[model samples]
Target chain A: METIVLGIGETLVRDDRHWASWANWLGVPAHTLSALVGAAVAQGRDATDALRVLRPGMDVDEAYLARAAAGRGEHLDESDLYPDVRPALAELRAAGIRVVVAGNGTVRAGERLRALDLPADLVVTSDEWGVRKPDPAFFARVVEVSGAKPGATLYVGDHPADDLFPAAAAGLRTAHLRRGPYGHWWAEHPDVVGTADFRVNALPELVGVVGGSPARPGAEPHSARPAFEDGTGAVGGARPARVSYLRGL
Target chain B: METIVLGIGETLVRDDRHWASWANWLGVPAHTLSALVGAAVAQGRDATDALRVLRPGMDVDEAYLARAAAGRGEHLDESDLYPDVRPALAELRAAGIRVVVAGNGTVRAGERLRALDLPADLVVTSDEWGVRKPDPAFFARVVEVSGAKPGATLYVGDHPADDLFPAAAAGLRTAHLRRGPYGHWWAEHPDVVGTADFRVNALPELVGVVGGSPARPGAEPHSARPAFEDGTGAVGGARPARVSYLRGL
Candidate 1:
């Protein structure tokens, strides 16, 4: 793979604190907020849309400002990252693959992600780009920023609707991380289960998806042996498949 | 190209009458509405967003209802079809390319398009899908319905921000149809100017972009000779290029 664009929440970092913080601010029980978030996700809507359901006509931006004033705004740190993030990112970068961490987070969240100094060429959030996921513009921005052609690039995320489907639609290869609630739930989605280019449980598996990296097996590089080359991609008869693991995984 | 997903407005059909109808209903000169629509498009906002600018907080749905109540609801017929649309679509279909016509039109527009019984395999509108273009989901729907992989499908549209860029992001090959104001205006956009896979002045050019059809040159069909192959697509080194007719036309 020429590049791997990772989704921030749930892919690179656990969103427990993030959602809990919103719950705390909204004066709702954490479980209540979490349940609502899950419900929203199950319906293929934005996670924060749960907030709209909980409070009609809620101004999320205003609420964010209110939370900031109350000393509880978007924040991130090394501890928030999944265990596989550091090693996988480092290995991918070592393999010469550009790594970008982008997803539906806030401007402050973007700042926090940058501050964490993740092993990524770029770290950004939806708010920073003034757009959100599932919108073609968000993925367009990701591809634009990565400087990789849509097919040469890969988008790794947990959410099926927000991440995998959109990224796939935007012409980027997709790796569905089978972690997080959305991941597990959407993994069974007909489209994701049947067509995802790479189905990985952890970030480290991506190194394999892109092909054995120099930092690992040192096999022929992915760029040299493109996946989906002859329209016999992972899902044969679909489009181009990468590297041809072609397994359900 | 396994499939060609043609955009509705300004691609297969002109939007003059549609916009004029809205202007008439809104009690504004057609020129005024047209100018405002262009302004919205130039700003990279939805064309209907111009209505919001014309009358603050105007409920477009409500306005449509009002107009419909006055027997001036959404309407379309054979007259709206651009002359190139019929022959281009018919030739593409005869050549075995799945043709899908989809774009940001209303439910009534979808019915009207279906009523036209265009040569396209499917005719759909954004309202029918409950999602609008510039949204990856829309393109994803186009791919899903066409049963073609994103890379194998070509999304032809006139607007850069709405049609070309977003479709490119979603992994479908993009052809910027140089027609109407949005087409010409967005064509000069740095991304569009430098990167659109196929820049065609007419739908007939798309047939060539896909490669010589049997009805024409009788050369190898487009699906038989994929563009963007070997990372030298229309915009070389971007993704898969179809037929290597990379040009700035």
Candidate 2:
């Protein structure tokens, strides 16, 4: 249970800039796009649905090309990541935890994340794999790249639909991080809170998730237990962890 | 537990060409160099000692440079690999085993192995890490890169002294491969055969080591058992597998 696999968007990088950039290209008020994005998440729809909702019958691919031609073509800089990301990742790797980054990102996004040189062993994306999360095959790929049994691997992400439930169903241990808009809204979802092994807020909290390590900067040691608490087998019954972010946002 | 970390020299590639080239550079009979290598292995000495014995006070680095100057610095092509290697590795990867290549090889050798594009998830050399085999730190690095607990990782190699015994001592599951001069002579070593989790003759036999998989092209299922037979914990006591390589060579 020394491996920790994390989702990319909300778990590692803040998606605020990515969405704001899209809002700028769409010639819509940023708040309008944010509201639509939040509504999409609340209704368990893909975030891209917001874009489709704004411009009905719009070709998403063509819009992507148009946006690129007009200049902002999916850039990822260090500023896009959560403030706690670097230290937590460094601590996890220093403690010999195999930190893997896997989630729904484009190939270019994967390249940018690698360019940042965050202390992860492997970083991959859905676009690179030709599959998206919540797909059982995607979870299988996670287990494959992890090179560890599902029970010995922990999949952490901010999305319940895309990250937690499916990963749990796929036999991997789950952690629900209450970051990003989706995480904030879905933090109270009965299924996610009920199925998660660790319900954490900040990224640095992962240092405490693994054994024999001090909490990294900004880590508040709460809720998460030993990584192997469930033993070396897939999730059988529900092992819940409460979302402690109630009072914050 | 789904990860298999292997030594490169005799487990995957045949060392005949490498040693022959070195003999060519040293201007010695191939058999003489081969016999010296066998003798060095038999006496529990490092294989490099043989080159030292062949030509007293010979600067190995200079010999390497001169060999390179002679247009045969280091060459690793398809023919260097054993015929069973590709099929066995392919089956392991297809079955979702995390195959890692970690061994006492030069950086150039590591690059050559990568160029071959074998089905390994990671290929690294001691030169890359600035540490060599039989060192506990090197074995620790194997578990680190594997991102699995030491109890769940398996270290396989042909050399008993550098590969089997040391890996076993460093809390990893061990397999003794009876392949080259080292493997053939050390197959009978009381300590190695007495400590290995699997003792095998050919690479393809590994398809049977993991769970729920058909044997590869040339595999003959013989002595290995389920990966988690001893359960998830470091090697506390010896769990031996006999060297069934009594017939072939």
Candidate 3:
């Protein structure tokens, strides 16, 4: 089966502004907070590192941090998706593609995913795995959990170094979701942009990039290899068994 | 009238690869040629300037250049538009919006427009105007030709300084079409991205950004000030005469 492992967080949710909002709430300069968060993300560090760096000398409050994280979660749950996200995810799922959300997201993001009822087979976050992206082990774990060979898998994300390069290095087809903070950063480097197998602005455009899903009724035929068999042993030959797991990575 | 002036070249067609193809045909490195072309475009120069730079010391063959240009035109004529472009243009025109194509494109591009029979009230090009975008007079000419008040018009383009900044400076609502070479470049700078009233990845998303055409059946109501007065006379009390231009700008 063709598995698509998406680096969720900002790829699916509008989480870039969360850092700025949290900074504003905590009386920190938004730009300073954004830069610190950006630096942490670029280094493949977790959100905790960002918080620690932003509040170095201050008495950090765990409960207040939890509340702030929850606030970000609520913001995400309140329909903060890009316009093409919902329909594209629906179409991909309906077409029988195994969609997974793998990222360096906070625990609250996973909670928000459940609250929003997002469609995906598995969601693996750094909070659960203790390893963030740009780490080869993280992508390997995602491929293993998704039951897809790196060659057959498609890993979509916004970051060039943190997401695209590492995923590409791991042998998965990489797509650059050009929208968020990292996306803007990636755009500046032509060499990085050239590395992505596909660079799309909207999520729905992936339907065209990945080829149309066969299970979608009345969907136009695409040049992409079929995701599954047509039962007559013509197109894909045979339908692969569905891979499912209930535990976090 | 609400006029939408689109930066036609790559915004409406796929013209990037053609440059590389032409460069290869002329025995020049694609990257070197691309950089030279980019430099010219960054200064708001036209296709002719790019050509002059590309073939600086060469024995220029006018016939060969014309044939190559025509080849590019034919490539464009073969439905080289983005997936969302056609439907979006049709819907906008059906809604009685005056659409115009304004850009720093070659004369062959204008011919391709005629061949494709694209829906537009006027088609303007640097080839005809003797000036390119980011030049205040070029935008002024567009405003004068379209009979559109700058505030009421929407200028959609892919470039930051070349397209978005100049149009915005002229007091037009600007939309950054986040595709093509310049789109990727513009996304890198937050300051430039912030200048655009709308930053869209897909052309169909414009139906949402620009209020959906009232003529489209089952269109949702939007909060934008109505482009024209309704019979109820509550919003936009009096309807203005539609500006119709039969000739090219």
lDDT by residue for model 2 (B97-144), tens: 899999988899999999999999999999999999878889989989
Taking all chains together, each candidate's TM-score versus the true structure is 0.44, 0.45, 0.40
Q: In the order shown, what is each candidate's alpha-carbon RMSD?
A: 22.5, 28.0, 20.0
Query: Which scores better on lDDT, 1 or 3?
Result: 1
List the candidate 2 regions with Cα displacement exceeding 4 Å: A212-249, B1-249
Q: Pick by DockQ: which candidate is best?
A: 3
Q: What lDDT tens digits, residue by residue, belong to model 1 across residues A1-249? A: 698899987898877677768867876434345545644444445666767755668999899888888888777888788788999999989988999999988788888888888889999899899999979999999989987787778899977767877788887877788666556544544566544666776788788776543211222333222222233333512432422211121
What would the DockQ be for model 3?
0.02
lDDT of 2 by residue, A41-75 (tens): 44445677667666667787788878788787889
| Candidate 3 clashes between residue pairs 3 or more apart in a chain or in different chains | none
Say which prediction, candidate 1 or candidate 3, comes out ahead on TM-score: 1
True contacts kept of 3: 0.00
Q: Using alpha carbons, what is the TM-score of model 1?
A: 0.44
